[model samples]
Target: MTEAAGKSYDGLPGAFRFAFSRSNSWLFKLYVAVALVLAGLVTIIFVFALIVLIADTVDASDGSISLLRSFFVLVGLLVVLPILAPVLFVARRHRREIGDDTGYDRRLASTGFLFIFAVYLGLVVSTPPEQQTSVDGALGPVLEVLYGLPSIVGLVPPVVAVLVIYGTHRLSR
Candidate 1:
């Protein structure tokens, strides 16, 4: 009977408890599952990037900027699923397993980040590399900024998602 009350006594938000709680009150295994997912997502991203690099080298496009923009598009799409699903599933399963409130409110948090990532990627893809920035970015420094920006900012979303969900999960335990 690993219902909400059965599984958790802290009376935290349903989404928090749901995501970190284990099946049949198996907190330890739930932690392990989260760890595995984190590990797998990293590997998946690494392999995908390697493939993209290989593809680019084989058919070097004159429009490297366009290809780089497409890379950001791919990165966002890749990150969204891994960042979102398991956490939401945890919240959802709680409703069925333990009669929790279904955490619709908390589950919607995923959409916010998703939309942000989509917008950021769209900007990266649409704006020409030289004009992507706002601070008079047509010069060489602008090109340097554009080249560096994606790799730097591109990494933040996944790391933030991991930190947030992992923090919540571990704190629950």
Candidate 2:
């Protein structure tokens, strides 16, 4: 019985690893594509926010920055540096894969991007707007803009991602 079962299993295909799967379903591709783009955007946003925070603190400092300000900057830098590693790794891998002759996995790229975006979004949404606005001077204005032009701001990422993906696909061909 065991021998027969093993033979039957061997004849079947391998298990589906979520990130590594090569299935060409449109829904899966869409999900992944959105995810990849989101990840990149989130990372960029995070780095930008950190820079803005540090800059604001420095500007406000009159040659006597508070210990709290210094500590916050130090902590933000430490956090941002580590977060950058995965983003850089994914980017480098994507570049190499695209340049290679063996064709790259769009799905995998999408999955990675989506994962990063989800994490970033989760963190942002979890934080109260009041706290975020207090920490970053730009947040208040940015939020106002987003609120004022919800339709435009909401569509930007998806539209840009589609154009980028389409351009890359065209170039690769």
Candidate 3:
């Protein structure tokens, strides 16, 4: 039988793994399942709030799609993934330790920061025409630095999560 049928998230702390534990108690498992669904609902609500916040903060002059506005919204949306990544990564790693290889962890590790970099790189290519022409001046450098700062900052959390997860995994081994 599979581990989930009888095993639990052995290496994880009780607090960390409570929702993910594969305990034998049917009621506990059902409660966890319901909690997960509720968590998903909360995340959906968060995304909607983020969308509204971004839309309000970014001024799209004449109701046209400004590259700067798009950048803000995309970065906001991108943040949602990393927010949940570490918890999910830890749970999966602990589950694997207990002999439950669901095959999702491999995909998660392989993708890593590729998605974040890809989207950020795409945004980098969309430099506002006004900014492009000022490339030779002093303000140009400052503007470019300011423009790229958000994407650079956005990369930190996911990269840190990956490093922390790898470090912990290595130590566990």
Candidate 4:
């Protein structure tokens, strides 16, 4: 039998060739690589924040605030994990779809990944804790719960979620 040839889209139209070529365009690869790296970094940061929050709880001056802060940190991780895990899957699979002739939702998924990350960034670390509710250096009753990262990280998920929903819908259609 004749040797099986590699994918040959030499005669295909330019756009089709680009889409189904046996490799990713530099743009797609770079986008995915950057996004994945960011996600990993963010995950590590979240874990570290979690550990700090937990360790701080043992001898916290005010147990309520410590407990609340710890609770929010844990909640934030739960939210982040779902979004981050899917990104890793889509990014790896996009290699074939962009390079070796495959079909899948790449742009939409990548956008979702970045969107969630940006949101988490805002929610978890939106403001400096020292400045959140420290007016004239007189701590307020709301000081503890008010300065947490989760409250701010909360902003990212909804926007990312909306984008993801739209992207998925477009992909489906």
Candidate 5:
């Protein structure tokens, strides 16, 4: 049997080499870092909002609060806290690897933006309509603002991702 040799791109054109080197630059890494951070923050915020919604639902139920409900909430936190953090971390790391190898920052940015948008959309769709109604006093607007925020804020993550990518590209050169 013949031994296999490692693959080489040594004979590739200068443009291909330059493209590969540029993708591996510190600037590209910075872009990936910022994208990952923004994606993480958006995910965390959405999860927190979801937790709060669940807690509020339990508290507002007409029946006496039961240990079962509290237990479920606790279980939810236990499951989600551990699972989500690492998943986000691993996902970001994977994205970094893809970006580094392929120079696919725009595609990564788009995917991250879509993920953030979907989370916000889910939050908005799941929220109770009653929660959106106006109330008297200073708390009314605040509650409304809080509940209405997901829809309004959904546009932000993608925009920020694009800006970060663009800014890093410009700064790197």
Candidate 6:
């Protein structure tokens, strides 16, 4: 098989290669990576602000200027649009190329698993002990380990849903 074909095997490295193949320059890849991170952070902030605003509205907070400030932050998320467009364009092109690769499914499965595992590990480790679940079970030490899992484990299914959407980008065609 060609080197490119060999790179399409079932793994995160392969997925990285496949996703980044369109751009040969490391600099450009770094640029895209930074842009994606920034966009993701801004989107997260916008969502947080929206949730806070919603909570305030539900509470019927005394008429104040703070609500207007939160609305402005929500609107400010639009400033990231210029950075988002080209990043999306690159992703769309990569999605289109998935059809040409015989190993796409395998790569997607493996990469999705690894990504989820890594993210969960990070979340669990970073979460404070107070935030984790505690359960008494029959497994002794094994149960001790399991009991330390955070409530954020509830987020795994949604994360998997996102991975499905990302990995099956070609479905949009």
For each candidate in turn, the TM-score is 0.34, 0.29, 0.32, 0.45, 0.30, 0.35
lDDT of 6 by residue, 1-173 (tens): 34645444355334344546654445445545655676578678777776776676776666565667666674545434433433343444454453443244333433334443544454554467667555466645553554455656635643554455355545533
**TM-score-better candidate, 1 vs 4:** 4
Candidate 1 ranges beyond 4 A from true positions: 1-77, 99-128, 131-150, 170-173
- The 0-to-1 C-alpha lDDT of every candidate, in the order given, reads 0.50, 0.43, 0.48, 0.50, 0.44, 0.50
Per-residue error (Å), model 2, residue 8: 31
**TM-score of candidate 2 to 2 decimals:** 0.29
lDDT of 1 by residue, 31-141 (tens): 435534553665577678767766767656567856875687666556554444444545555544533433432433343344345445544544556565545545656
Q: Which lDDT tens digits does candidate 5 get at residues 75-170?
A: 444333322332232233333342343334344433444444544454553466665566799977755665666554644544454455345444
Which segments of model 5 are wrong by more than 4 Å? 1-103, 133-173
How would you order the candidates by TM-score, starting with the best? 4, 6, 1, 3, 5, 2
RMSD of each: 12.3, 15.4, 12.2, 11.0, 13.1, 13.7
lDDT digits (tens) for residues 95-168 of candidate 3? 55554443333333333334344334445545554554446667777656645555445445455554654564
lDDT of 4 at 136: 45
Winning model by TM-score:
4
Q: What is the lDDT of candidate 4?
A: 0.50
Cα lDDT tens digits, model 4, 22-116, are 33444434444454566567678878887777787767678697678767777666555545443333333333343332233345445555665
- As for lDDT, the candidate ahead, 2 or 5, is 5
- lDDT for position 124 in model 5: 52
